[model samples]
Target: MEENAIRNKYQELGVEGFYTQYGADYSNPHEAQIRQLLLQNQDRIDYNKVLDFCCGSGEVSRTLIEAGYGHVFASDPFTYEAYQKNCGRECWQYTFEDVIRTPIPEQFSAVICSFAMHLCPDEQLFPLVYQLFQSTSQLVIITPHKRPELEQLEGVQLAFEDFCLTAKGKQVRLKAYTSTFTY
Candidate 1:
């Protein structure tokens, strides 16, 4: 799909609605940048166990797996088929709201939310992040825009951050945060 069309669709339907309507067919146009960001930050990420939160088409999981990180898990309210087909793994059907309601059962070394954290509504971000921190000490968010600054929230501290630029010179950032809350 052309970039403009995708952007227009997203703008038309809004994030949640766009994903709800076209998630199975969804694909990240910035795969190259995402791959670069993950590869460059591999040393920083804990590979013990990682959750590919909002794992759209398993882009993050695919990159990490190809790099020999075998302990990646995934969850998305939408894109289950694409994720399973691409990553050859089952994806938990959990939305931000779901996580806030009931935290993930398993603990993770790090939870990576690529290209999706910004979609979370402002009102729910804190509760969702609080619940996520209960499941993982580290939360890694990769986004094209700088919204949803996790560090602004209490109990979340920025540990490290890096970025890769697209061909158009847009920045795609990978920011890792550690929970200050005692788990």
Candidate 2:
């Protein structure tokens, strides 16, 4: 979906029910892998405010908050209320067009986005990456599909696979990457 079309749709239709669709604790599956990756790179991340960009339903944010991490935020075009009720942290809901129109919030210690990067429009990908880089020095991106383009960026320091558990007791392989780019 194009940026404007999604924004228009959300404006007219309102945010959809989340629990009935994506469930509440949907972030658990990726927890172990995320923890492992963080632990492996603890020396780099400054443990400052973390933003889970494209955090659908705020599962990741809720998990982090529950784990006692402070200063965490989430952002997505929809799922604002779900994130509020589930994570209890502040979140910004912005469409691609909205992001393009307005500048992303300033600096973050780390920006973690899981399972949603592939949904980004082709034209918006570069800008989104640039935005992320500008907003944070540490970037963690996990996508279910291949995004070789991200590897070509200037300062992606790490790339690995994260096996996220599925509802069916299976594991879904996701491409996990870390971009330690400043600016």
Candidate 3:
């Protein structure tokens, strides 16, 4: 799906329904690996204001809060009210395009996005990455390390050391990589 198309589809997804469908807490193999990577780099992340870009169901933001992050803003194209209600934090139903159109209210000390970047093609993803780099002091991107992933939402279901394929096609292996930078 194209960026504009994805934006439109998610915009119609109401908060209550979004969670019932794609809530973050759902058992995903990659979840533990992602958490470990974040934990290992705790010193690098800012414990202050954080933004979970494309925070599907607020699971990462919720985890960060529990890990002592002061405040977290969970934003996604689909507004999952269940996450806000159950996670006890603010949730914004904003598309990635919206974030680009309008700057975030407060600068984020640490920005985390998981299983979201792959939704855009490289043409958009690289620029989007640059944009993310500008919005926050630190950034964490968790996506499958494959070309196709740059344009689709299909993520690898991680197991121990490898990410299993979620979509049917030439199976691609995901090697978790955590690239961090401080500005």
Best by TM-score: 1
lDDT of 1 at 48: 76
Ranking by TM-score: 1, 2, 3
Which candidate number maximizes lDDT? Answer: 1
TM-score of 2: 0.66
TM-scores, each model vs. reference: 0.95, 0.66, 0.62
**Candidates in descending lDDT order:** 1, 2, 3
Report residue 131 deviation for candidate 1 (angstroms).
Answer: 0.5
Cα lDDT of model 2 overall? 0.61
lDDT of 1 by residue, 1-183 (tens): 677887798899987788889989988989999999988987898967999999999989999888888999999988998898887899998999999999999999999999888888999999999999999988999998988799999989999999989989999999999988875
lDDT of 3: 0.57
Question: Which is the better candidate, 1 or 3, if ranked by TM-score?
Answer: 1
Residue 156, model 2: Cα distance from true site in angstroms: 4.9
Each model's lDDT = 0.90, 0.61, 0.57
lDDT score at residue 101, model 1, on the 0-100 scale? 98
